[model samples]
Target chain A: MAETPIRFGILGCAHIAQTVSRAICLSPNSTLYAVGSRSFEKAKKFSEANGFPPSAKIYGSYEALLDDPDVDVVYVPLPTSLHLRWVVLAAEKKKHVLLEKPVALNVAELDEMIKACEVNGVQFMDGTMWMHHPRTTKMEEIIYDPERFGNIKTVHSIFSYGGGDDFLRNNIRVKPDLDGLGALGDAGWYCIRAILWAAEYELPKTVTALREPVLNEAGVILACGSSLQWEDGKTATFHCSFLANLAMDITVLGTTGTLHVHDFVIPHEENTASFLAAAKTGYWELVTGMSAIPSQHVITTDLPQEVYMVTEFSRLVKSIKDGGSKPEGKWPSISRKTQLVVDAVKASIENGFEPVQVRV
Target chain B: MAETPIRFGILGCAHIAQTVSRAICLSPNSTLYAVGSRSFEKAKKFSEANGFPPSAKIYGSYEALLDDPDVDVVYVPLPTSLHLRWVVLAAEKKKHVLLEKPVALNVAELDEMIKACEVNGVQFMDGTMWMHHPRTTKMEEIIYDPERFGNIKTVHSIFSYGGGDDFLRNNIRVKPDLDGLGALGDAGWYCIRAILWAAEYELPKTVTALREPVLNEAGVILACGSSLQWEDGKTATFHCSFLANLAMDITVLGTTGTLHVHDFVIPHEENTASFLAAAKTGYWELVTGMSAIPSQHVITTDLPQEVYMVTEFSRLVKSIKDGGSKPEGKWPSISRKTQLVVDAVKASIENGFEPVQVRV
Candidate 1:
């Protein structure tokens, strides 16, 4: 084992930062190194409340944390509107980025962040924690199995939460200047990522926005959906909202099999996650019911998925630090593809729900 | 109790009739009274093979069964193209109609059939057996309970079954003049009905067909989908296909709760059905996972859902016969509403995937 842990510095006191803070503490290869907020006193309070070690630094500004030589990685949990500026600056300071989702306002902004990380030789990975879960790897194995899954024919994903009157009116996500894409960027980001993940990151040929996307008074999307069609004739549809009950579903249907994960964004249990799969299932005699039932597969981990994400990021950062290995290309490649689909969907919604081609 | 059981006369030897035939035998309030086919030998074989009693009649022509005074209900399982002619004739003979769905190729045809039933004082119900499942009632109780489900916001239903090469080329559903609308009228009919049922029979204001529907060479839709928007901002989307794995899903999201039924079309087991419901579910502390997991509720019945459908149809007929009641209006009304949505989806698909207003 390495003597020094990859040090993590948090950029904000955002709600999601608390989760990442716990994960950084749980990861054996990483440590909570610092936290920065606009107010030094607020940063101190947050650090104390979240179990920061005595040696961890506290800074009054994000720039202060970026300038700290001890901070090897910065987990950016700021709003999408602030991601481009902070992430690029952090990369210029040679800090690896494990950025929160809806990484930027648009693909152009995300491209700039990616280039910054590339220029500085720092790793870039989105904070989609579910992708790091062991269950996700198991699901990918089944989806790619030629004998069982066959060719994927259709995919449907939904990620939504009832953002009550308070969040709808007061949250930064609903404000046009804060998270301009609104629910499409917040809840929708996971759905798009799930679709791209199931399709093996092969970009769709065209994406058409579903009609009547619900938008707030500030023209921020409150709820929206889109359909994507691939050149191989595979298709997908996803719905995201801030106005419905909490639901996270990813149902993928291949010609001979199906995969259903009701709580795909987050598992019901932290230690174990499960998914249902049916391969070559059939109907009962006379069609009274199904002949073979779907089998539930459970995957267990020693740590939560967020911890796994931190550990993975720290592993890459360590490789770059001690092993002289180049940064991993898989993480940012998938993130860029997911963001490309998001851009295409937004374009379709803006251009009167027309079909917009997805360009890499 | 009425001394006489409702006698069911089946028209045509369609494969679906085999399931309904078993249902008729299992239903306590009904009996398989007769069968008709274009050939006498075929009618005799169908009657003998499907548990028809020794006294049951076999007719060479459908008109012969319709004219029989002993047949109180005619279960029409003929191809959809023949429904307009045979259903009108059966209703004219004062027979209750347990018609297979889609009840007609279009709502106009369905309206004609409904008028014929009303003029003759005969009850009319479609063969959507899942609606009669005890589990369905339980689901409605939760979805309708104000404290549990709250106001409905969005719904999604998917019903798809993969069709092999032989099925695609040879099935009556693929023949233009036989089933005409193909999978849309077959599988999509169930999806539309489920959406209407969840929304309490309220028709959507606009229906837009998803683009790039897969169609056969004869111009029959093999796979299709649509999005519906209600005037009150309630929305629904459904996908029906003959090119994916068999999947029957109905996921409803209310303001405070969610309801999920994976095998909504047919239960995975003959003796029981289940659904999952989560009310006011929340995230766990630190956002590790769901705070409250959804609980599975199972309902068991001695008879299959198809038998329950037959028993319910017979009860309605017996009410008109024994209780001196007019034919119940509920069945035809819901059937018409389902057909209206089906018609709207079909029109939208035909009209360049435009948003067509549902004219109820």
Candidate 2:
């Protein structure tokens, strides 16, 4: 017997929507059932340009797409400022929500969306695609093994891309009404998540923003960095910028080992990724060289990470719709934790770079 | 006929002295002429174990070794506390000085040593061996290329080694009266140098030590980190610890290029080293992957970095002794700058983690 694929309806034709639309088509347990935009012409064009099935529906308004009874899930790729409204409405319509990152303008708004999803009994997961990659899983296996990695003492992450002068002046990300957080919300989201993920999702005791964050005239952060410290002496630092060249890095140092990955947010290749790990590393005789070098581990996947994310989200949606199971709490919990740290960092920046306690 | 090699005298027989002794023997322009310790038997044993030539002299006391008119240079491997006394004495005796890192207890002490060397017309070079590596020069060339690397934005460096329980309890680095700066002086020195090297030796405007520094009972810093901010908005962060695995890394992010070197302090292979550089990197279509991966550049050398250090120092010494040229000021200037930053970080930590202005 074959299980029916979950039907997906995408809200807004944002640039990222095109990628998620393709992911829905590629995921084995999901189908791109519909797409919605402000105008019928735009929706129709998106549907035709992407490989949407001929039977897929196109709606002129997001409301019409959410009203469709056949849509079991809605992937929201709207700007961050619109997330609270669209995500809550989709949950009210009993549609599983796969929201893009920088989940909301702040944690308070995200809490409303999460509450709506819980009350409606629909799964909710953010669109952090790299979390589903097989390479992330492989690295996790080594880091989690005490004998292999020991206790993680510190971490450093960087995610930055050189957005041209035009982007600095005109990109939606730099606009206050759009993605407002700018570099901190876009590129920095990945770095923050990387640090928290390296810490096994443990929230830090305090967050302190570093000095000299570059800001646009509209007061959106163009570049910034922060340090996180835990009560048990664990610490981490991260940098994110829209002014530097494309660089995605994560370095985790443990009591007896270290892990390094240069392309943590997006792999350089679609189907393959690699990470370096060293356990019990030491120096050679006379301290002239390393006793053993870090070994590189390559992970291969049949599908891109976005598709894996879609497949996983759909699998959870199927259990709720067909098997009468409850929504998984892990995804939403992780999202809220990341947002909490994000909020703390912003508060520290606003508070004159003082250390801000991370509240629950 | 080949010009006469610079005759070298070593003070103390610390473990590092063995490595530097080997380097002196290997360098073409340096010769292991004499060694000294508190006891003549220990000096004789060290000379025999370190492959000194048959004509090598052994002295019961450091003062005796420094008094030898034939010894053109003295390599001081004594503890930080003894550096001021021994280095000043060596300089006054007309011997060029190759002082081990953490050159002095503080900038003031370092200034005294430098002044002594300057007044006596003797070369002064700190034994930061990696600075002499060919790989270091290759990395510098790339980072300094404005067309390729653009403006430097941020840097992160880490140098850590897990010293085990016994080392944590008994090592001289953890003893306040000996290497009082502990990991900051030993491992952190390299990280600071790396950050400065990335910035082309521009001093930061201020420094703020991160919270939760691990300190020994004697108040020696075992693990710590700091964030440095430049007047022009450039920033750098570094971490050094005796509690983590052996990890030496330097990541430099620029406006148009990125540089990463995992084994910046000590190469994995003595004969070869490598670093990754990416210029004009961007995302692929749909933001699925990178447009181009970073290129790996491998630099090979015929001599070990420590040997190169000895050769370079000896070259300067020979130039002063034989060519009638004054000692090069570049080496002392760099060493002083590095010490100044080290002093600032320590001051920041002592001052309740507040930002401390870096006074030149």
Candidate 3:
């Protein structure tokens, strides 16, 4: 018997939603069934432009879309401020949630949203597309290999982009009441996630923000960085900015090996991604040169990373819908851990760059 | 008329001397004229094993080598504890000094060495070979190009090696009375120099050591890191360790571009080096991919970087010897700046990781 495809209802038409809509349509187990905006005209316009099939529903209000029993899941790409309201409402209406990152304004709000999903028996997953990339899994295997890489030592990550004058002045990412967290939530989130990923998801004991963070007039972070320390002597640092050139870097140093990836956030090519790894790197007899040059490991996939994200989410949602299985806990657990570190970094910055203890 | 080569006298035969001796022999303008050691047997053995010419003089004592009037330049590879005494003595003896890095135990000692060279009209140059690599010059041009790289934002560097148990127990770098500063001085020197080079040699305003540095029983740093902030908000962070795998990385982020190099300290290959440069990197229409992928810039050279260092140092020495030119102040000035940042990091660590103000 063939399994039924999960039907997705998208809430609002954020810029990111366009990409997610495409991913949903592309995924084998997911179909873009509906889209809802504040008005019927906007929803129809979005659905027409985004290649939604004629059978896809267009709703004037989000409530109407959530009320559709055919919509098994809702991909919420709303701004951070509105996540709590829409995500909880969608969960209460029995729709699984795939929420955008900077998952909430803070952990407290994220906790409430998680609770609502839990109470409604709905699956929750954040949209960190890179997590689904095959290259990430390959990097994980290499870094955690007991012989090749040994125990982790340090990690450094940077995720930044030149947003230019218009973005700095006008984007929702810069508006205090909308995205609010600005570069820290938008870009630094990826860096923090990379560091945590390198550390195998162990929350750091403390996080200390670096000095001289660039903040806009509305007190939103434009650029910032922080150093994290684990109890076992592992250390990590990350920087994120809206002012620097576009960069996505992750450098992980272990006892016996190193891993470097320049485009961890977004692959330069759609079908291929790569990371450089070196094991037991040493110098020549006279220390004139290195004995081992890092070799590149390329991973290829037919589908884009976003489609993978959608397919995985739909799998979890389908298992719960048809197989009588409980929602997968791993997705929300990782999301919570990432948010904890983000909150600690924010606290460190707010406390005049003092070290903030990270409580699990 | 052809120019006469600058005559080079070797100091006590440290392990590094073998490489520099080869470099001296390879440089067209530098000749290995004499060898010196505490014992004549050691000097003779080093010279013979290192392929010195039969006519090269072997001295039983360092003083005898310093007394040789034909020794135009003295290459000092002795331990840090012996640098102040031997470097000053060589300078006073009118031999141009090509000293190894971590230039002195402290700036006070370095100041005395510099003063001696100034008084004796001898050239002073530190043996940081990578500075002479043509790739370094090319990188400098790119980073300083305002249109391509724009204003510098942040720099991160790492130089570390897994020194194993034997090295941790017995290496001079781990000994309190010998190298004293341990990994901080040995590996951290290159990281600091890279940051300064990226910043065009402007010393940072403040340096704060990161927490939980791994130290030996003698309280010498085995692994450590620090963040430096310049007056203009240009920030840099560096980590150096004897506890991690060999890694030499430099990542510089500017408003418009980025530069990345993995093997900045020692090239993976002797004759060629490369760096990745990305200018105006942006995302695709839907932010699924990069619009401009970073391109690798491979640089090749006929002579090894060490040979270039020797050639450059000898060229300056020859100008002083033949053209009656005053010693170039650039080399000593940059070495001093690097030492200043090193001192500040040490102070910050000693003061329980408090921020230490850097003085010019």
Candidate 4:
């Protein structure tokens, strides 16, 4: 008996496409059958350099690639502004989609994509690969289990970096129309996604934001804060900046203790410690041993990006083949909630940081 | 040879006055010579109970006590509404003053008090006692020393608690006219003071704030954030909350490591840990074998409150006796900068969280 592999097509030869291409090639249950770019020459060059089968089709237009009946699932790694168009088109072709982060420019586009997938009887999953990591799973279990981490009271997270001039010159991340929220749409979504995933995809009730717009640039928010409230009466906050030096840290405070994770988005090989303080006397005793590590975890992989993307794509393929939902699939809920947070942040920036309640 | 004792008088028997009274009685070079309350019976009772000498006077009116030539200093712990009037009157009477926190209702009042003290050639100090503690000196030294703490990047601090019903029911902290900014004027001042003091009183260029009015029952701000810029081209942020459960934590981040100071405001026997990461490995290591000392230094004596108050009052007396500026004195600078931060927070709140540029 031989195992059958799901056929995958790559749309848009963007840098992110390399991630999906490698994942599809490496997964035993998936195959990269075809690829499409705005230029046929570029598509052919990428396929040949990446060791694609000679039978793998190359198309100059995305629609031409979508016309292939053999392409089972389409991986859309286009710019943020083009996600809705390609996702809906892929669904119309009776194909499932693995859309990149900032799934769409706003909730309306996401809603349309969701409806398209439902009407076509196809699956739609946002490409939030961090959610698939083993460490993320461990963190979620610890944070949600009352006996392990206790009831969460507050969450503080930051993701920031200084995008050098060469990187910002011609990148879609700096474009107002394509990227919409700029750094927020580019990298902040991961931080927002991390919070939502940890909170079990609970939509927050209110979001307050403050943005320092990049000078001489319109629709580019350099820094922002999104304060979120869940229906279960839990609150969370996400802070992000693009004009500052790099930083990625997430801290979750519960009634009994706090869990601090560093570099949450990119699982770096680092050690983290949790500090617990229950009573006044206990607090003093704990402070004395604060520098001692009770536990430490290490990741030795230099390919976290490929590892996360492959795990999520493999799960998506298995779900389609079995005619069942993906394992712990919270993509739709997470996507919708992330869109709410993004919209609230924009509204807050426009209103001078007066908190905007998220209706969703 | 005997040390000359400074004569002191208190105008009210407020809650804070109790702390000052105890300090006066314990200082070796200070004497509580008189006390004045609106009710004669209350003044007489307090004087007798506190063991004032037979020569000590009890007055039914504050005006009579101020007229006493024997009194060299006065402590004013009245309601926020009466701070300006009494501080000015005390200064006019040629008495040095130790005015309680929230120096005045607004910056204008603070300015008036500063001017009155200057014109009368009398010393006036805002009783921001946290700066007097040894821990403050240690924190400043650690944060500013690049070799020890590296480049300061971020700061987050919180102060909150639950108060007595009566304290919230009829106190000026609940009234807009007297308490002004409410919780912000009362408990929130400590948080603002800590951040400004840690930043060495470098005013921020722009501040953005968000106030949740529903959370403040007694004219208090439930939560607020102020984005600040230092003269050294660094950005800092301060957050405060009164409605949440008790929490006082301050975390300072630098390039090489992070200093996490638990229980920042009233750090009673709490401890802090430093986590460092080298540039090459980018691996964070918890520096071990560190002793857990009290988060704050205890200036203990037979009477702790008295010892704390006298520590500052005596400094002022010695400065006057020397007829020159005290090199060790930080009261003037700390008080002025604290008032500046308080004023900025108030202006940000009033203008609907508009960025208020701090002047000097």
Candidate 5:
């Protein structure tokens, strides 16, 4: 028997919601049934332009969307400062949530979200699309094989992008109160998540951080470094910068050898296109070889092959409908850990880049 | 007129003295004029075996050697624990001093040494041989060119060697109170010094360090990581380990590209007899190309390359004799900075690897 598609209602007409909506439309067992935005005109336009079915609905406000019985799940794509409020509301409405990256701004907010989900008996998962990528699985396989990679000694990860002057204005990225965290929260979160996930989500024994502040007439950290360690003696160092130009790379050093994965966050458009073409043609070798080349030339051409976030969301909906326990041991925990790390970064910045012990 | 060679004195008959003594013999404008050891028999044996000129004197003790007016400069290669005391004594005696690597156990001791040198009106330089190597100068030139290498973003350095269990027994390296600083201060000094020198000896604005203690009969650090920042917003990081097998390499990442120099601390040995014959017969290109390939198939050999420390010491002697200030920008200040960094590592270890501000 064919499985019924899970219906999704996006809580905000955020720019990220477009990515999620596209993913839902393309997913084998998911549908973008509705959308809600503070502005009624924006919601209606989003629904119309995205080709929502006649049965699909548009709501002027988030609460009205949550009240809709047809919506089985909610995709929360709100500002970092606003995540906790909508996430709890969505969970209270008994809708499974795929909250956007950085589950919440801090551990306290995350704890509240988790509690609300538990009390309402709803599944809560973070939208960490990279975890679902086949390449990440392959990385785990290679790193765990003692004969292949050996014990990891050090991990150096970097994620940066040139956010020119225009990038700082009219975006949540540069808003000190709304975003709270800057480059470290936006891009650096991915690198930190990848490391902790690869290290089996082990809580660091100690953490020391440094920050570079690019304030908006008001002082706040706009960039930073968060260095961490495991009790068994492994070091994780991450560099997060906003003033610097675009660069996203991760390098892990082990006792036997090293492994590097370039463009770990947002892969090149060409790589994705080629990957999809090869996937359609059953040419796995060509896809793998294309991925192996580290040059930007190949990556820039290949990355647009698939919509990573939508694909992961589709899987989450299927898992929930099948009554499986929330894609056990995956994105939820990873995203929570990522939020904790960001919280630590903020604490360190507040204390003048001092070492802050992460509380799991 | 040709400059007069600086007459040098040996303060101890240690293995390091043998290397220095050989370098002095090979230098064009330097000579070993006096030998000193706690044992008269050992001093006489060393003088006779090394063919010290008949007019050269031997001293039964360090004080007697300092009393000899002919001994214009003293090379002190005592154990790590004794470096401070003897350096101070040599400065008080008004003898130009070249102290061995790891100028002192910590910043406090280094400050004392610096103060002593200033008050006594004598020249003092740390014996960090790599800083004087022409290859190192070439590396600095390449890394600092903004058009060529651009701004450096990351520095990864490693130096490790394996030693037998018996080697740890009775060695100062294994004694925390004697060596005071373990692998980090003993061998990792070069790795830190290399980064600072390559970065034009910029003082880091912030530092985060992690250390691992190796347990034998007593606990000693075996590995460490340091993240540093320059005032101009450039950041650098380094790791050092001694528990691993023999390996020494340094890699720098810049905005434009990456550069790596392998086997940086030591060059591969060359067979002098075969090389001399090949050169005389005009087989230079073929022989040199074959030798350039790094592999186990090549035979171990030695080259007639210039001795790094001896050449630098000769230049320092000339600078002093010419009545000019010591080389304005040299390795001593860099060495002091590195010592301060290592001391922070020690403090971090004591405080459970918490972030400590470097005071240098």
Candidate 6:
């Protein structure tokens, strides 16, 4: 019997949808089945521009696309303000969700989205592409090695990119209504997730926002940082900004090992990823030099990270449909944990940079 | 017609003195003239093991080394508690002082040391070797380049090393009476200095110690971190530990550039040092990847860093002796500022992790 590919429906013709649209076409387990935008012309243009197959359908309204029985999964790339409406509607229509982040404006909205997916018995996942990359798993192996890595001590992550004059002036991310969380939601989301991931999904006990985050005239965060403390004395710090040069990095320190990756959010190449690792390193006589230099580990993948993300989401959807497996709760749980930390950081920032307890 | 080398006296036979003694010999304008310890036989063994010249004088006590008029400069590598008494004696005896890090227990003690050097008209410089390396000047070029580096936004540094079970129990760094600041003084001194160096020696406005710094049973810091914020919105964070792998790194992020060095405290190699630098970087279209990778800049130094440090100290001493120039105040000032920030961080930790305003 031929294996059936999960069909994808994309809501909105967002700029991110262009990349994910290509990913949908590239993923072996998923098909670019339908696209919906307020203007049918925009959906058609997006499909044609991004190599959508001729069999792919287009609709003027998201409702039409979600109503299609063939859209086994919906990838919603709508603005934060519109997520609650469209994501809940997609769930009610019995479609699995592969949602783009923020995930929502706050935890309350995210809870609703998760609840809707739960009630509909559909898989839910955030569009955090890096998590699905093979290199991540490879790095995880090094981090968890007891003899080499030992117990975790500290982790630091950053995701900052230069936004030109035009972006600072005109981008929706700089506006309060469209993407209200600003850099905290856009770039900081990845930094928080990376810290949480390095800590093995253990939520931090406290989150304190670093002082004086840069904000736009509309009060949207342009740059911010936070320090998180765990119950076990492990510590993590993260920074995110749209004002600095493009830099995405994570440094994980353990009792005996240290790991560094310069591009964790987006690999420099489509096929290969690299990270620097050092285990049991010591200084030379007189502390003039290191006993051994850190070695770089490169990982090659058959598929790009975006495609990998789509494939993973599709695989989860297929498990429920064909394998009689329940919807995977891990994905939504990760997203929720990430959102809860984000809320704590934002709260810390709002509350005069006081350390806020992470309640989740 | 010939330049006279700065004569040197060793104040104690500490482990670090073995390295600095060799550096004094290697430095062109310095001579290691005297060695001293309470146990004359121990001092004699150290001098023999570390290749002290046959002409070098050995003394039964540190006061004998300081009292020797031929000893133009005294290099003090004693534990923190002994620094005030011995260094003050050396300075008062009209000998220039080249002291080890954690120059004193606090800023107040550091001020006394600095004042002794000032009143006695003797050059005062702490033995922070990396600052005098040629590679430091080369990296400084990139950091100060407005076209490339722009305004510094953030600086993150770490200097951590592991201690074996026996060393953890016995090393001076872990002992409250011997080196009261523990890791905060040993490793954190370099971390704080790196932050200050990257910030062009400007003291931060506030220092907030990160929560839950690991302390030993003797109430000495084993691992700790702190965040500093400057008035100009630039921020920095550093972590120092005796409980983690050997990792000395500095990550400086600017508006238009980023600089990364895995070995800021001590390079992985002796003669060659490298740093990763990227200027005006951006993401590739659709955020698929970075437009350019950070290039590695290798700097070759003919002299080792410790040798450079010694040569610089000797040159300052020579300028005062030969050219009748006043002692340079820059080095002592840098030490004072570093100690001030260190005091603030320690105060914050002791005061239940409150944000402490840097008095400087």
Backbone clashes for every candidate come to 0, 0, 0, 4, 18, 0
Name the DockQ score for candidate 4: 0.08
State the lDDT of candidate 5 residue by residue for B139-249, as single tens digits. Answer: 666667777556666565665544335646766776877775777776688778777766777766666564444445567766677766666766666666654433344
- Which prediction has the highest DockQ against the true structure? 2
Give the TM-score of chain A in candidate 6: 0.98
Whole-model lDDT for model 1 versus the true structure? 0.92
- The RMSD (Cα, Å) of candidate 3 is 1.0
Q: Output per-candidate TM-scores for chain A, rounded to 2 decimals.
A: 0.98, 0.99, 0.99, 0.89, 0.86, 0.98
Q: Lowest-scoring 10 consecutive residues by lDDT in candidate 1 chain A? A: A284-293
Q: Which ranking of candidates, highest TM-score first?
A: 2, 3, 1, 6, 4, 5
User: lDDT tens digits, residues A1-360, model 3?
Assistant: 766899999999999998898898899999989999998999999999887999999999999999999999999998899999999999999999999999988899999999999999999999999999989999999998979999999999999999999999899999989988889999999999999999989999999998888999999999999999999999999999999998899999999999999999989988999999999988899888888779999998898899999999999998998888999998888889888988998999899888999987
Query: Per-residue alpha-carbon lDDT of model 1 for A1-360, expressed as tens digits?
Result: 557999999999998999999999999999999999999999999999998999889999999999999899999999899999999999999999999998988889999999999999999999999999989999999998979999998899999888999999999999989889899988899999999999998999999999889999989999999989999888889999998888999999988888999888889888988999998888876998886578899888889899999999999999999998889999989989988988999999999998999998
lDDT of 6: 0.91
- Residue by residue across B191-276, what tens digits does model 4's lDDT show? 77777665666666666554433345444554555655555545555555443434555656554434555455544432322222
TM-score of 1: 0.99
In angstroms, how far off is B43's CA in candidate 6?
Answer: 1.0
- After superposing candidate 6 on the true structure, give the runs of residues whose Cα lies further than 4 Å from its correct spot: none
Q: Name the lDDT of candidate 2.
A: 0.93
* Candidate 1, DockQ score (0 to 1): 0.79
Greater DockQ among 1 and 4 belongs to 1
lDDT of 6 by residue, A1-360 (tens): 768888998898989998898888899888888999999999999888988889899999999999999999999988887888888999999999999988988999999999999999999999999999999999999998888799999999989988879999998788888889999999999999999999999999999998879998889999999999999989999989998887899999999999999999999888899999999998777878887579999999877799999998898889899888999999999999999999999999999989999998
Q: What tens-digit string does per-residue lDDT give for candidate 2 at A131-231?
A: 99989999999887888889999999999999999989888889999998889889889999999999999999999999889998889999999999998
Residue pairs of candidate 3 with colliding backbone atoms: none
How does residue A44 of candidate 5 score in lDDT? 92
Error of 3 at A274 (Å): 0.7
**In model 4, what are the clashing residue pairs, if there are any?**
A204-A229, B23-B306, B182-B219, B183-B220
